[model samples]
Target: MTHKQKPVIGITSGDLNGIGLELIVKTFADARLLDICTPVIFANNKAVNFYRKTISESNFSFFHTREFEKINPKQVTIFNCWEEEVNITPGTLNETGGRYAVTSLEMAINALKEKKIDGLVTAPIHKTNVQSEQFSYTGHTPYLKASFNAKDVVMMMCAENMRVALVTEHVPISEVAKQITAEAILSKLAIIHSSLQQDFGISKPRIAVLGLNPHAGDEGLVGNEEQTIIAPAVKQARNRNILAFGPYSADAFFARGQYEKFDAVLAMYHDQGLIPFKSLAQGEGVNYTAGLEIVRTSPDHGVAFDIAGKGRADGGSFLQAVYTCADIIGQRAEYGEQRANPLRKVSPEVVSRLEDEKIEE
Candidate 1:
């Protein structure tokens, strides 16, 4: 956790047919990135070489390892999880690509739980194809929540300026309204508040909660969720000493630059938050699974299957994910230290008593 001793960051090569490996290789190609953290990729050497050659990125290479202890700090390492021959068909969706993506993710998660890696930065995975008996979740947030046995977790998408957390994820738009309740809104608010403090190191995070309906239900003209569900939840959160406010109309909140006034924003659903975040982030956003004991992050974008093998996929988001993971690890370490030995604030009466005692002495 020191400046000289870098944290080991584990990267999961997403679907083989996707741009996972390409981003991994391109991100690590910069030698200066090694100064912050040691990267250990969960992928086979064959797959790595395949992508390297396909992208004409010969300068990129990784140290092959079968054991965690064998990872090299000065160079990037690729831990081989599978050796079976599989066709590396880019821009195609198949079960084989999904299976290997799961394999790489499983291995990386094991390493993370074993303390071999400090944090995890995952690549994009084809959610539908990656579905299997072992993995039955909708996305990474839920999977990680179950993996760590965390009771509640928030899917927070972050950039330099804007940070947005979702109340409902991976659910259909029709089911979204049904899922929006006072309890659900309150739970997400609590998680978002706690995560902003612990994970991002915010002392008193100001969170803006977006309404479920348009114009925040037009004051209950369009929908009653704002009054019966979201507004009540905001009131309850405020009563509980959480710095939460507003069942703000989503459109005006962003349009008026009101998001910048708060530490974080909680959206009611997926597109409500992601659309604005992606548009404003300019391809530098990171999807962070907050409220978990361990740190996990991924690029905000999904697997670019259309442009998978053309060597045209942008690595900016993936690189930002890596840097964001490292930064959160450091921030959490510092937060822990501060929590262990917090500075005491002396009241005026206590200070007067101390002064009197000093005078008597």
Candidate 2:
């Protein structure tokens, strides 16, 4: 089949007032994207209708189906959740809009679980707006883990030349220092290694790890996470044939294209990795959840409530997210047909079983 005829990409319309809808329209306007993959927006038909009236772009065609077997790559589909005529004024965050943002995610996640879509490309979701007792787990990575029952998962953010994995996320700076365990480090390293090889097609991946404090704590002058935790993790990973090194200081690590020297970097917390990533990427990064059974991706930036609907939301970030999702789906489809989600088949208990067999041999 041709590129456009590949598979339908499920995109969740994040917040009605945010730039998600605008970017969706803008991104698909480029006819070249239609040559790659068709977007299956998991949102209401009325929302698209309103956006078309406001923006005057009416290229959206819908494909409605309750089952996975009806998904066709030829049509840009819309699975409407609620038909209440939504008044989507750009840049305004309301509770009603937030409710829509969440329902879109729930439906898309369900679609991914049922293998209805090739991959999930979520728009930016407002944390305050995403309501539900079950949705109370940090960000998308943790939410995906909770949905998939994955105990250990890592967040890897990537641009063209650089990718960085997170060791800790969505925690206070004070609490991050206390959360690093040897087991946690090793598990993240293993996941990073496997992901690099499997998804990125890297044979032997190299990872550079960052320190928790400034100056890497100046050799234990200010803090000791380097000596106490990070260093041990690095050594363990290296012993396992994973090239992991450095408790590098975060701010100074990005000089003269240093990120190109390694396949991925493991940051101690959120800002340490993303601050540099966003700076280097300049609103072109793809936020990827690495430890999921099914591939999950989103635009690196949050809902740009500031620049919502002035016809100014750039489609570059959203385009990148779709491209990354399609690339992953294509790669994995070569290995296992219809088994796009690994979480359904691969469990930690399964890993333990394989390891036991090797030991017995």
Candidate 3:
């Protein structure tokens, strides 16, 4: 495929019984999406058809094929990963849901590795059900980290107003403090820094670090994590020429609308970042996995078990996930091109003269 061709995005049907397919169907129903990126859903035709019935308004249709060469840019494609007839119980958690979710993900990742898909956009999955011998990780971030052998990956929740990256993801509240080290902070910072530049096209991104305690530890009265751990990490980041600041109180930070001032914010843990991000996102939040070899994005929300087959699942976040995935792919390509043939640094005198020179129309 040429660089000018539309990117092929692999979509994983999360838990079959959940809102995963619902979101996918609703988002792709708008045929205009096919114009930007061709979607290759890694799922069984039966399963997709099952969910398609739930969403009455969905006009989503697809070509059924197992071959990547058969993929059509103008049509949605269902890359059949399995042909077995399985029971799909919407809003119910079962082993079948977990098994098929894993199957869909495995096939999609394989396609991604084989370069059949340009990027990946995953729907939500049940954490407990999707665990076994092959998939033992707590969530997608860790699973993907191990899948690609990445040293580390940052779970960044993105929206229009602000972007938030978590320092510790899916860890217990008790173990959260134990995991907050300077090295971990710096590692996440590096990923977020590079991601901002390459994925989001931010030239000089400003990052804000949130405290691990209330009122930023109140100068050691509430806790010393801000002083000893988070603050020092911020300082170390600054020394590395990263524009990182603060061990600011998380509550005051969002309450005061301080996040709008920076390009991204690095929160200490999952809830610290997500709670505020989801609140501000207005259903358009995208969960992006940074520091990975391949582009992957997902809706910030999880599987809605209660409203799975109700046709009430909002596709805003899922649509944004697709949009963000395609955007980052383009951004990475442009960033790569710029890096390959970067402009030479000019002298200050020459720059001044060029700025002062008048151009003829």
Tell me the lDDT of model 2 at 10. Answer: 88
- Mind giving the per-residue lDDT tens digits that candidate 3 earns over 223-304? 9999998889999999988999998999999999999999999999999999999999999999999999999999998989
Overall lDDT per candidate, in order of appearance: 0.90, 0.80, 0.92
lDDT per residue as tens, model 1, 1-361: 6423688999999999999999998889898899999999998999988888877644786789798888889999999999887798998999989999999999988998899899999999998998988999887888999999998889999999989999999999989999888888888889888888878888899999999989999988999999888888999999988999998999999989899999999999999999999998999999999888888999999889999988888999999999999998988887777777463345778878988999999
Candidates 2 and 3 compared: the better one by TM-score is: 3
The best candidate by lDDT is 3
Off by over 4 Å in 1: 1-4, 344-361
Stretches of model 2 off by over 4 angstroms after superposition? 1-5, 56-70, 335-361
Candidate 2 per-residue C-alpha lDDT over 29-83 given as tens digits, one digit per residue, 9 for 90 to 100: 5656665776788888778656655565546456664555666666666777776
Q: For candidate 1, what is the total of clashing residue pairs?
A: 0
The CA lDDT at 336 in model 3 is 81
* Candidate order (TM-score): 3, 1, 2
* Candidate 2, poorest ten consecutive residues by summed lDDT: 335-344
**Number of the candidate with higher lDDT, 1 or 2:** 1
